[model samples]
Target: MKISNQNKTLDLTYPQVMGILNVTPDSFSDGGRFNHIDAALKQARAMIRDGATIIDIGGESTRPGAAQVSEEQEIARVIPIIEAIRLESDVWISIDTSKPQVMKRAVAAGADLINDVRALTVDGALDVAAQAGVPVCIMHMQGQPQDMQDNPQYCDVIDEVADFLNERIAQCIKAGIKRENIVLDPGFGFGKTMAHNFRLINQFNRFLDFKLPVLAGLSRKSMFDHLLSLKVDERLASSLTGALLCAQQGAHILRVHDVKETADMLKIMNTVASATH
Candidate 1:
């Protein structure tokens, strides 16, 4: 499978890693690390060098209890970095925002995909994504970041997520977004409990029922913290384990922080699978 826009094309026949670049001051992990333009460029280069085919740049922290950033502030935080990277690299750039204005400007600045945690539910988001003509990743989040995890309840998490994504896919199509231009994320940590995350990953293939690409983002997430009592920085081992597990379960893209490590794991898994075949 592949995700493509006018300026970029990402091959997903084999699992790919999307390096996370948060240009926010308070993301749960790696916040305030690359808020500067040069710093963001440097990190982008490192991830590309580390085998990241996609660089997902987020201007707002969507961590639970995270404050919302205005569209102007978000565009200011991310556009310059997008332009700078495009001047030097053609790597797939994913604008990670739900605001329509931010989405419009980021794509104009050279973003190739829209990765919205809200699944385009924000007013004007669907129209902007449909008009931008880039691949859109619709993630499932039950509530706003401020209260999503306060008490996320689901009679059946996988089924509920699948139902939500399916509905979003239908909406996108109705809005004129091409089927090939849509991707699905189950929103591993957005509104899920630790057990909910595990079940989602295990039954991940069910999401492919839409026949769209599925993105799994479990890198250094709170799920590991809750399950293993490990802090964010100390979750690399657990994170890589989750990546490998997701890939084995047919995840098309793995949004991650440890790019090189996850890339290495995918290499080994691919090699062994090829040998077996």
Candidate 2:
């Protein structure tokens, strides 16, 4: 499968690595690390050189209990970096945001995709995304980020997530967004308990029923921290394992922090699978 905008295209026939570039000062893992223009560009180029097909740029910290930033602040934080990246590279860029204005402005600046954790439920978000004319990734979150992790309950985690994504897909289509331009994420750590997270990963194939590309954003999530008693920096091994498992389950995109390691793992897996086939 291929996701394209006028400026760039990502071929997902093989697994694709989407490097995470959080331009915020409070993101869970890499906050304050690339909040500068020079650092951000350097990291973006490094990820591209390390085999990343897409660079996901986020201006807000969506970590649980995270506060929100205004549209103007978000635009200020990301637009310059987006512009700088475009001047030098043509790699696909994804704007990770939930605001309609951010979606529109980021696309104008050079973003090729919208990766909204709120699934465009925020007012005006659906309209802007439909009109942006780019690929959109709608993720499922049980509640607002502030209190989502307090008490995440579901009768059946996988079925509920699938139902929510399917409903959002219908809403996007009804809003005039083409089905082919849509992608789905089960949202591994967003408002999910440890059990819920594992169930989704183990049963991730259930999401293929939608017949759209699946994106797994499991890098440095709290599940590994809680399960393995490891800190964020120590979760690379766990993160790579989750990413490889997601690829094995047919996930098309892996939104990750360790771009080089994930890409190398995918390369080896593809090589063996090809040799067998």
Candidate 3:
């Protein structure tokens, strides 16, 4: 499968890595590391060189209990980076925001995809995404970022997430967003408990029922902290393990931090699978 925006296309027949570029100062991991335009662009270049097909850029920190950022502030944080990257490379750029204005500006600056954690529920978001004519990744979050992880509850985690994503897909179609321009992210850590996250990864393929590309963004999440008591910098092994599990389950895109390591791991896995075939 492939998702395209204008002249750019990302083939999903094999899983693709989306390097995380958090341009915020408070993201749970790697925050403030790339807030400068040059730093951000440098990271983008490195990720691309390391085999990343997409760069998921975020201006706001969506970590639980995070402070909210205004639309102007968000645009200021991300637009320049987007413009700079566009000037150099044609790598797929994904704007990681829910604000319609930010979405509009990012696309204008050359973003190829919209990766909204709110699933375009924000007013004007649906319309903006539909009009942008780019691939949209609608993620399932149980609540707003400020309080999503306070105490997330689900009768059945897998079913509830699937139901939410299904509804969002229908909404996107109703809003005039074409089916081929949509991607689904089950949202591994948005509001999930440790068990909920593990269960979601194990049953990740359940989302295939919708027949849309599935994006798994479990890189260096707190779930690893809970599962193995590892610190943020120490979660590489666990993160790669989670990524491999999701890839084996047919994840089309893996939003990750360790681009080179994940790319190498996927290469080995693909090689072994090809040999077996």
Candidate 4:
């Protein structure tokens, strides 16, 4: 599959890495890491050198219980970084926001994709993405980030998530977003228990039936901590494990924090997978 964006189509011939760049002081996972333009530009180049095909920039912290940022604040934080990355490099850029206004401004500043955690349903979000003309990654979350994990439950987690993604994809199509510009995410760690996340990871390839590339954003997620009994700062090993597992499960894209490690793992796995075939 290929993601159509800005007169270019990103061919999904192998597992692609999307380095995470959060311009926030409260990203829950990597807060205060790259809030400045100089630091962010350096990190973005390093990821690209280390083999990241995409740079996903976000200003808001969608981590569980994160307070929302105003539209102006969100745009203020992310757009400049997006523009800086574009000015420095041409790596595919994904704006990780759900707000319609932010989406509009980010795209205008040169974002190649819209990674909407809300699946582009926030007030004017769908319309903004439709007008932006970029690849849209629709993700499934049980509720808003502020309370998503408060009591996330599912009688059948995988089926329900697939259903939600399917419906969201249909909605985007109905809203005039091209099918080739669509991707689906199971939303690991968004609003799921460890069991739910494990099941989704184990069965992620089932989503291929939707005919869109699958992206797995499980880096440093709580599931790794719950399974490995590690602190957030100590979960690198588990995060790499999940990234590798997701790639083996046929994930077309991996949204990750540790890009070099995941990129090295993908090099070996892709070589092995190809050799065997």
Q: Whole-model lDDT, candidate 4?
A: 0.90
Candidate 4: lDDT of 38? 89
Can you tell me which runs of candidate 1 are displaced by over 4 Å? none
lDDT of 4 by residue, 207-243 (tens): 8888889999988888877877878878788888888
Sliding window of 10 residues with minimal summed lDDT for model 2: 1-10
TM-score of 4: 0.98
Model 1: lDDT of residue 158 = 90
Q: Write the per-residue lDDT of candidate 1 for residues 152-271, one digit (tens) a residue.
A: 999999989988988999999999899998999999988888999999878888987887899999999999989899999999999999889889988999999999999999999999
For each candidate in turn, the TM-score is: 0.98, 0.98, 0.99, 0.98
lDDT of each: 0.94, 0.94, 0.94, 0.90
Backbone Cα, N, C clashes tallied per candidate: 0, 0, 0, 0
**Top lDDT hit:** 3
lDDT of 4 at 160: 96
Tens digits of per-residue lDDT for model 3 on 18-74? 999999999999999999998998999999999999999999999988999999999
Model 2 bad stretches (over 4 Å): none
Model 4 misplaced stretches (Cα beyond 4 Å): none
Model 1 Cα shift for residue 162 (angstroms): 0.5
